[model samples]
Target chain A: DVKVTQSSRYLVKRTGEKVFLECVQDMDHENMFWYRQDPGLGLRLIYFSYDVKMKEKGDIPEGYSVSREKKERFSLILESASTNQTSMYLCASSYGELREQYFGPGTRLTVT
Target chain B: AQSVTQLDSQVPVFEEAPVELRCNYSSSVSVYLFWYVQYPNQGLQLLLKYLSGSTLVKGINGFEAEFNKSQTSFHLRKPSVHISDTAEYFCAVRPGSNMLTFGGGTRLMVKP
Candidate 1:
C-alpha cells in the first residue's frame, strides 16, 4: 500500500506565528501537492511541486508557500498564521505516468 | 485550465437504496477523471478512476463511475449503500498534467 504521512494530525497556532506542516510519501512519487479543505468549499490546491526545488501555485496559494528539498519530503509553510487560515490541510503524491494521487491523513490547523 | 462541478452538495439515502452523485468537468483537452471518498476527519481515498478504454470503471467498496465524453460528465453510482458508506465524495479532473481540479464535494448520508 502507498503510504503518505503528515507530521501532525492536529495543530494550534497563535496569530502572526509561523507554522510548518510536513508531508512524506514512501512511494517515490515525483509529484506532490498541498491543499486546504473547508466545510462547503471542498479541497482547494495551495501549491504543488513536480521536482525538487520546483514549485507551482495552485488556485489558492496566497499566504502559503511550499518546499520540496528532497524527493520524499514536501513541506507547507504558513508565513504568518491567521484565524482565517484555519482549515484541514492535506498532502498528496502521485507517480508520473499514472495520475492517481495518494493522500496523507491530513493536518487540521486551528489559528487563534 | 480544467474545472469540475459537482451538482449536488448533499445526497441522503436510506440503507440499501441506490444513489448517484453527479459530476461534470470543463476542459479544453482530453481529461482523466477520478472519484475520491473521505471519511470524517480523514484524508481523501481514491475510489475509482477513468483514464482510458472502457467508459465504465469500478472501484473499491462497490462504487463505480461512468465517463461520458459527450456530456462531459462522470457520475458515481452504487446499487445499494450501507451505513458505512456515509462520507464526502469528490470528483476531480486532470486536463493535461499532474495537477487535478476538484469539485465541491457531495456529502453522502446513509440513514437506516
Candidate 2:
C-alpha cells in the first residue's frame, strides 16, 4: 500500500507563532498537495508542488507557504499562526499519470 | 478552472438503507471526477474515480458512482450502508489541469 506520513497528528500554537507541518510519501510520486479541512467547506487546497522547490497557490493560501526540498518530503509552513488558521491539515501525493491521490493522517491544528 | 458541487450537506440514514450522494461539476472543457471519503480524525481515501471508458464506476466499500456527462453529475450510490459508512464524502474534478478542485463535503451519518 502507498503510504503518506504526516509529522504531527495534533498541534496547538499561540498567535503569531511559527508552525510547520511535515509530510512524506514513500511512493516516489511526482505530485504533492496540502489542504485544510473545515466543517461544511470540505477540503480546500492550500498549496501544491509538482517538482522540487516549485509551488503553486491553491484556493486558500493567504497565511501559508510550502516547501519541497526533495521528492519525498513536502512541508507546510505558517509564517505567523493566527486563531483563524486553526484547521485540520492534510497532505496527499499522486503519481504523474494517476488521477487518484494517497493521503496522510491529517494534522489537527489549533492556533489560539 | 473546474469546480464541483455536492448538494447534500448532511444525510442521516438507518443502517442497511440505500443512500445516494449527489455531485455535479462545471467547467469550460473536459474533466475527470472522483469521490473521496474521510473518516473522523483520518485522512481522505479515494472511494472511486472516473477517468475514461464506461460511465458506471465501482469503488471500494461497496460504493459506486456513475458519471453522466449529459447531466454533468457524478452521484454516489450504495445499496446498503453500515455504521462504518459514516464519514464525510467529497466530490472533486480535475479539468485537464494538475490541480483538483473539491466540493463542499456531504457528511453521511448511518444510524443503527
Candidate 3:
C-alpha cells in the first residue's frame, strides 16, 4: 500500500508568520498535489508538482507556493499566513496521469 | 474544463438504512470519476473510481457507485450503513488533464 505522511497533523501560527508543511510518499509517485479544504467549499487544489523542481498553480494558489526538491518529498509554503489561510491541508501523490492519488493524513492549520 | 456538483450538502440517516449520495459532473469529453471519503480530521481516501468499462464500481466499506454516462452522474450507494460510515464524501472528476476537480462534498451523518 502507498503511504503518504505529513510532517504535522495540527499546527497553530500567528498572522504574518511563514509556515511550511511537508509531505513524503513512500511509493515515489511522480505527481504530488496540495489542497486546502474548507467548510462547504470542499478541497481546492493549491499547487501540484509533476516532477522535481516543477510546479503548477491550481485553482487556488494565492499566498501559497510549493517546492519539490526530491522525488519523495513535497512541501507547501505559506509566505505570510493570515487568518484566511487556516484550513485543512491535504497532500496526495499519484504515479501517473489518470491514476488514483493516495493521500496523507491532513494537517489542520490554524492561523490566528 | 470539468466540474463536479454534489446535490446534497448533508444527509442524515439511521444506522442500517440504505443511503445514496448524488454527484453530477459536466465535461465535454471522456473523464474519470471518483468517490472519496474523509473521516474526521483525516485525509481523503479513495472509495472507488470509474475509468472505463463496468459502470458499477464497488469500493471499501461495502460502498458502491454507478456511472451514468447519459446523465453524467456517479452516485454512491450503500446497502446498509454503519455509524462508521458517517463522514464527508467528495466526488471528483478528472478530465483530460492530470488535475482533478472536486465537488462541494456531502456530509453523511449516521444516527443510532
The candidate that achieves the highest lDDT relative to the unseen native structure: 3
Model 3 sits at a Cα RMSD from the real structure of 1.0
lDDT of 1: 0.94
How far in Å is the alpha carbon of B23 misplaced in model 1? Answer: 0.6
Ranking by lDDT: 3, 1, 2
For all the predictions, what are the DockQ values? 0.73, 0.77, 0.83
What order do you get sorting by TM-score, best first? 3, 2, 1
Extract clashing residue pairs from model 2. Answer: none
lDDT (Cα, tens digit) per residue for candidate 3, span B53-87: 99999999999999999999999999999999999
Backbone atom clashes (below 3 Å) for every candidate: 0, 0, 0
Per-model C-alpha lDDT, please?
0.94, 0.93, 0.95
lDDT of 3 by residue, A48-84 (tens): 9999999999999999989999999999999999999
Model 1, span A30-104: residue lDDT tens: 999999998778789999998999999999999999999999999999999999999999999998856688999
Q: Candidate 2, residues A33-93: lDDT per residue as tens digits? A: 9999888787889999989999999989999999999999999999999999999999999
Order by DockQ, highest first: 3, 2, 1
Docking class of 3: high
Worst 10 residues of 2 chain B by lDDT: B92-101
Clashing pairs in 1: none
